[model samples]
Target: MFKILDKQELAESIIEYTIEARDIARHHHAGQFCIIRVHSHCERIPLSIAETNSQAGTITLVVQIAGHSTQELAQLEAGDSILDVVGPLGQPTKIGSPRRGIFVGGGVGVPAGSSMVRQMKQAGAQVLAIIGFRSKDLIIYEEKMRAVADELVVTTDDGSYGYHGLVTEPLQERLAAGEKYDVVITVGPVVMMRAVAEVTRPYGTHTIASLNPIMVDGTGMCGACRVTVGGETKFACVDGPEFDAHQVDFAELAQRLEIYRDEELRAHEAGPHECRLEQALKELG
Candidate 1:
């Protein structure tokens, strides 16, 4: 059991947990993720490693309470133990001395991009970050991203803060203004990453995307996280959670993610049984 050393609410329905996993924390690099099981009966879920401290023997995971498993995980507090925490899985991002690089993130993807930006800066690259959210209340990791990036642009769809537009807007404008980038990295919803790829493709910029598909086992045995890249089959679990943006078949991946929608809805509707049943029994009494 891995103990929850710390927990912080980053935003509404979004929380960050620091877990005691010394071995994984010590070896994890940027762009790798961990598979966690809230309990023995719960399905395993994959989450990006937001930050790590080897000395502290902890790794930070930022989670959005999207479905049943994540909502249950969020209920855990400091000192609570997680049943299974398997990790340092998938290929780490390849950091090199690119002259200039752009990192783009949306919603919860911001935390996933944070460590990557730091690694890029450490490798002597001029990193620029563009992050998007629905509104000000949904934004997270702004200061963290700003600290590592040479330049940071925050955008909101509702005009609540920073620039009032999608993250792709500034990126498109920058490329239109003749700004050059050696590489572009993005992490977000499938549609958002697709948009980023479209924007960067014409400029001949190399783009990398961190994909979050429906994954069962963190290892390659399950075949649940299979995706098509360059017209070939690849498993996101072992081969990558990261891939070339140009080669990913986004439409197929998007469809596959919805395969469990009905089951997910049923789980959410059921909610936490103990709380639900206890409240109902009290009201009846």
Candidate 2:
């Protein structure tokens, strides 16, 4: 059992949990993720490794309560035990010795980008970070990001904080201003990533995007996380949670993500334990 050492509500419907997973913390690198099971019977869900502390023997996961599993995870308190936490899965972001790099993260993606920024800075790259949220109330990891990034630009769609537009605005503005970067990394909603890729493509800047698709098993065995990159099938679990944004088939990925929408809503509406009970009753009947 992975023990929850601490928990904090970062924003409305978003929570951060520090879990005691010594091995994972010690070995995890930037851009890797973990598959967690809230309980034995609960469906497994993937969460990006937001941060890790080797000495503390813990890894931090920032979760937005978007579904039944996440909602249950949000309800867990400090000292609670997670039934299973398996990971440090997926390839780490390849932060070679680039002279300058820009990382764009939206909403919960901010936490996922934090470690990458830190790693890039440590690699002697000048890192610029652009983080976006729906509003000020949704923003998270600002201070953490600022600490690692050479420049940090925060944006909100509603003009509630920082720049009054999407993260792409600042990125485009900088690129248009003749500012050059060796690489661009974006992690966010599919649409946001697509926009970033489009913006960087004409500039001939190398871009990487982290994909969050429907995943189960957290291993190559399931093939549920399979995605087409450069017209080839690649599993996000084993091949990547990060890929070349320029070659990704975003439309196909977006459609696949919605395959279980109705079923997910029904399960969520039925409540976690209640859904299990209904299944058990159906079996007996």
Candidate 3:
């Protein structure tokens, strides 16, 4: 059992979790993820490692309460022991030392991207980070991202703060303005990554993106996380959690992600699931 050391709600549907897991934290790296199981019977869910403190025996997870498993995770509090925590799984990201490297993240992906930005800085690369959220109130990890980044850009969809637009807009402006970067990395929804790829395509900038396609066991056994990259099928859990954004088939990915939605919807509507929608509607009545 891994103990929950700290858990805080950072924004709407977003949270920061510090958990105690000695083995995993000791060797965890950026672009890796851990499989979290709420209980003995619950299915495993994979979450990116935002940060890890080996000496403290703690690993941090930044997550959005997206579905049943994540919602259950939000219910856990400090001092609670999760049923199981297994990882440092997936191939770690490999970045070259460059004059400047830009990392882009949207919404919950910001925290994970922040982890790489820090490591890249440590490795002697000047890092410029672009982090985006729906609004100012939803932004997270700015202080942390700023700590390592030589330059940081924060953007929002609703223009509540920072650049007052999508991260890609500023990305294009910077690239177009001749702000050259050896490499660009983005971690976010498929649509966001697709857009980033489009922006960087003409520039021929090598772009890396973290892919979180549907994962079940978060292991090679399940084969649920296989994704086509460079015309070959690879597993996200073991082969990668990051791939060249240019090579990823985002259309297939976006489609496959919805393949299980119907069953998920049925599961939610079938009852026996705790849901906010039910409570909210009752309160309204």
Candidate 4:
């Protein structure tokens, strides 16, 4: 069992968890993720490694409560133990020492992208970060991203904070102004990632996108997280959670993600399986 060292709510239904996993924390690199199981019976879920503290033997995971399993995870507090926490999984991003790089993120993706931002800066790259949220209340990891990026641009769709526009707006503006980046990396919803790819396409910028697919196992054996890039197949679990944005078949990827929608909705509606009746019976006993 891995203990929950700390837990803080970053936003509504969004949590930042610091868990005790020494080896994983020590070896995890930028752009890698972990698969966690709240209990032995719960389904496993993948989450990006937001930060790590090797000395403390902890790894930080930012989790958004989306369905049953995550809702169960949220119920646990500091000192609670998790049944399984496996990883440092997937490929660590290849930073290549680009002279100038742009990192874009949307919603919860902001924290995920922050990992790469720090690495790019350490690689001696001038990093520009553009992060967006639906509103001010949804913004997270702003200070963290800002500290690593040479410049940071925050956007909101509702004009509630920062720039009153989509994240792609500032990116488009920058490219239109003749700004060139050695590479552009975006992590967000499929639609948002696709938009970033399109915005950079005209400028011929080399762009990378971190993908979120339906993953059963964190290993390649499951074959559940396969995606098409450059008209070929690759698994998100083992091959990547990141790929060339321009080469990805976004439509197919988006369609594949929705395959479990009904089941997911049912799980959410069913709520956490604490079995109140059984609990009451045990109390009587």
Indicate which candidate wins on TM-score.
2
Q: Write the per-residue lDDT of candidate 2 for residues 1-285, one digit (tens) a residue.
A: 999999999999999999999999999999999999899778777999999999999999999898777888888999999999999999999968999999999999889898999888888899999999999999899999998899999999999999999999999999999999999999999999999999999999999999998777788986778899999999999999999999999999988777655556777888676444234324434
What's the TM-score of every candidate structure?
0.94, 0.95, 0.93, 0.94
Candidate 1's TM-score: 0.94
Instruction: Tell me the TM-score of model 4.
Output: 0.94
Tens-digit lDDT track for model 1 on 1-285? 999999999999999999999999999999999999888777677999999999999999999998877888988999999999999999999856888999999988999898999888888889999999999999999999998899999999999999999999999999999999998999999999999999999999999999998777779986778999999999999999999999999999998777555557766788654333223323434
Better of 1 and 3 by lDDT: 1
The alpha-carbon deviation from the true structure for residue 74 of candidate 4, after best TM-score superposition, in angstroms, is: 0.7
Candidate that beats the other on lDDT, 1 or 4, i.e. the better one: 1
Residues forming the 10-long window of minimal summed lDDT in candidate 2: 276-285
Q: Candidates' lDDT values, in order?
A: 0.90, 0.90, 0.84, 0.89
The regions of model 1 sitting more than 4 angstroms off are 270-285
lDDT of model 3, residue 270: 54
Q: In candidate 1, which residue pairs get closer than 3 Å at backbone N, Cα or C atoms, i.e. clash?
A: none
